[model samples]
Target: MPPLHILHIDASARPGRSGVDTRGSHTRRLTHRFADRWQAARPQDTLTYRDVGRQPPSPVSGEWIAAAFTRPERRDEAARAHLAESDVLVDELLRADLIVIGAPMYNFGLPAQLKAWVDNVVRVGVTFGFDRSRPGEPYWPMLPPDKRLVILSSRGDYGYDPGGRLESVNLVERGLTVPMGYLGLTQTHSIAIEYDEFADERLRASISAAEAAVDDLVGKLARDFAEAAKPSLAVA
Candidate 1:
């Protein structure tokens, strides 16, 4: 099978890995471990890392919106400048078969940086297409359906999963998956570490379980991609 290209994005404000740094990010730890496991299992697979936590894309502005709405051919230098970073981001997203995002929940939602990254990538005429002619379905995804998105998150409280205590309020996964799905990345998987504020046995256990989940997810995805790549045999 051909080697897959993975885009790894870290969105935690906290730097370094947990247990390595006294006050490190659990999301970072999970994402780093996932990447390491992927490399160990498939050394030939390529990875592109983007640290939006530290170097975030600029927030969307009026000029940026106007530029994005403008036709590519008609865009002037100023318009291009407004969308240069977004273009690079969209290119990265297009090249990646698997996207891993380490999103530590901030105020029960996404971090400002990750939000900005999402805004930059979900551009008109790039990730999604819009048309007034097709009133029934004017918008369509531009990305292929095969792309997969894995969101590794960390939260201070527990019970964020489906039917959990805080399922409705948990916006990290919903916020990310919705936009990603709109871009044709409907294959979304998420794993999170809870009880961060407590920092007790629950926190430790959550971390361990989340790490194990990451390992399992990586192995499963690797096998799935490999199997899908195998050529089908003709029947006589």
Candidate 2:
């Protein structure tokens, strides 16, 4: 459609891009390349980048929970203050047409910081709706159905893809997918570099492959979204 608004999030604790730093984060490299490629293709599009690894949002606490459950209009000053950060995060998510997340697997799961980010965005009466009377469907996704999600991830070991040896234990992508899907961002795609700990030819190959995949993904998504946004012609 019009210029796309992309939200780029980096959740790696490491400071530098891969290949540049000996111990850099692979996810960062992919995300940067993705953003660069996207901008080169569609110069008019806008990007909002958030580095949650270094500056994570506040974790969900008792006060945050209390404030979230409280009705917005009924909330007092304290309640509003508790949810202020969450409010900003939710607003950013709502504005994005495409969300790109750089998440590296930490101990078979998401990093603590990224999880905290997730907790903040999945707000009540904001990204989702809840009702006590509706027994069959008490919860509903609040975001529009067309929002797209891209998770560029890295892992210490290999075989984490679907049907792979370590798929069951690989919770990085699944963890994000469940929460994001709950918010109606089901158009998801993921590409990850594996064998990170090995730091050998395998890791190098994986990174190269992942970069190519990211480029392909960016091109495909940019074209697909543009096509989908075009108006259809009426038949005579």
Candidate 3:
């Protein structure tokens, strides 16, 4: 079997330590460890990393939008070049068998950098298309059917269950996952590490717990991969 291509995206601006305007460092740590485990399990697999923090693009502009929406054949040289960058990003996503996104909660939502990445990739009639074919199914997802996604999220406060004081209205996970599901990526999992209540000792414990969870998940994924490689027999 061929190696699985994994696209790893880290959106946290902070390179290390958690502080105001930067809290997703833990998410990056956890995802790096997870990626390590995944590569160890499948040595032939390839991982591509994209850091949106240091290289955020300017907001999409009218010219970019026009270029993006225009048909390839109709686009001029400069317009095609502009759209090509976005096309490359989307193509990378389309080529990957798995996607891993590291996001930290910002103002109870996704960091602006990550949102910009989404805007660049989720083009109309590409990732998704509007179809009035059925009365209810207005939008149809055009993404590949075989891709899986894993999200590593970190929050300052804990809110595992819904409707708690620290329960964030940010809804970044929901926003990403629902769209991924809409895009036909049904195999999605998220691991969150919360640290709002952690002191020195408690913070260490939180990190330990998060590491263990990643280890356990890695083992399960490896086992599943091995099982899937086995040939199935049909009754005569």
Highest lDDT model number: 1
lDDT (10s digit) by residue, model 3, range 59-88: 677888998788778989988777766887
Which stretches of model 1 miss by more than 4 angstroms?
Answer: none
TM-score of each: 0.98, 0.97, 0.86
Off by over 4 Å in 2: none
Clashes of each: 0, 0, 2
Residue-wise C-alpha lDDT for candidate 1, range 1-236, written one tens digit per residue:
98899999999999888989989999999999999999999999999999999999999999999999999999999999999999999999999999999999999999999999999999888899999998799999999768999999999999999999999999999899999888888999999999999989999999999999999999999999999899999999
Sort order, lDDT high to low = 1, 2, 3
Q: What is the per-residue lDDT of model 2 for residues 128-217, given as tens digits with 9 covering 90 to 100? A: 898889889999999977889999999999999999999999999989999999988999999999998898999989999999999999
Identify the candidate with maximal TM-score.
Answer: 1
The best-first sequence of candidates by TM-score reads 1, 2, 3
